[model samples]
Target: MRLTRPMLALTGAVAVLALSACGAGGDDEAKAPETATGSLEQLAAKAKCDPNMQTDADEIRQAICTTGKDKYILATFATDRGQAEWLSGAKDYGGYYLVGRKWVAVGQEKTVTALQGKLGGTMEEGSEHMNPGGSHNKGGHHS
Candidate 1:
C-alpha cells in the first residue's frame, strides 16, 4: 500500500468528518433537553434563580443564581462525562446538582433541588458540601 501524503490527508479529513457526525459520542436519550421549551433566562425564571450567565473553558453555559443568602450554578454539557466532571469539581465548592444534560445547579441543596423540580431533572447527591437531596417546597424565592 502506497501511503502518499495526499492519501494521508484525505484519510484524516474523512476521519474528522466521521467523528463530527457521531456528535459528542453519547446516547440521544441521555442528551435530552431538561426543559420543555424556553431560553436559559426563561428557565431561570421558572426555576426562581437569578441568571448570571457564563461559559466555562469547555463552553458549558453556566447560569449562576442567588436568593440573597443561598447561591447556585446551572449549566448544560454535551455529555454525561462532561457533566460528571463538572459535578466532581463543583461538588468540592458547595451544592451541585445535575438536571439531565441540559442543566446543572450548584448552591444550597434546597435551592438546587427547587431548581431541579422546576427544570425537570434528577438530583446528584453524595457530596460533603451538599445536604441530602430532596425538593424543598419553601425558600429559594428569586427576586
Candidate 2:
C-alpha cells in the first residue's frame, strides 16, 4: 500500500510523542521541599529521607542546628568520574537532599541523579545513592 502524507506525519508525531514520554522525570510528589527550611525531622519525615545536617560550614551552621534549630541534613559526596567530589565546606541535608545540599546534590540536570543518591544522614559516608521513591531505573538513567 502507498503511504500518504498524513500517514507519514502521523508516524513522525508518534515517534516524537514516544520520545517525550520517555524523557519525563518524577512528579512533584517525589520532590522534597525546594529549600530545607523546615524542621529537620519534619522534612525528613515528609521526604522519607535520612537527614545528615553537617556542622562547621557557615550556611550549614546557620541552616541546621544539632542543638535544636532548623534541622537540615548535611551531606558530602564523592564522584566516580571525579566531577568534583560533591564537597562543600559544610552542607545541610544529603539523603534525598534539597538543592545544594551535598556532593551529588540534585539540580535541574541531576533531578533523577540526586533522587538516586542515598548518601548522608549519619556522620559516616555512603557507597552509592538510593531512590526513596522505590522506583528502579528499568528503562535507563534519568535524563
Best by lDDT: 1
For residue 103, model 1's alpha carbon misses the true position, in angstroms, by: 1.7
Clashing pairs in 1: 72-106
Clashes in each model (backbone N, CA, C under 3 Å)? 1, 14
- lDDT tens string, model 1, 1-143? 33333432243233222322221211223333355334456666766667776544343555555554445655555456665665555444333354555456554445545555557677665333232222331245333
Cα lDDT for residue 74, candidate 1? 55
Tens digit of lDDT per residue, candidate 2, span 1-143? 44333432343233222322223244433333344333334534444555555323322221121212222222222222221223221111122223333322322213323333322221222212223222233445554
Per-residue error (Å), model 2, residue 26: 6.6
Clashes of 1: 1
lDDT of each: 0.48, 0.30
Q: Pick the candidate with the highest TM-score.
A: 1
TM-score of decoy 1? 0.50
- Show where candidate 1 strays beyond 4 Å: 1-39, 56-58, 67-70, 92-98, 129-143
Q: Report how far residue 64 has shifted in candidate 2, in Å.
A: 13
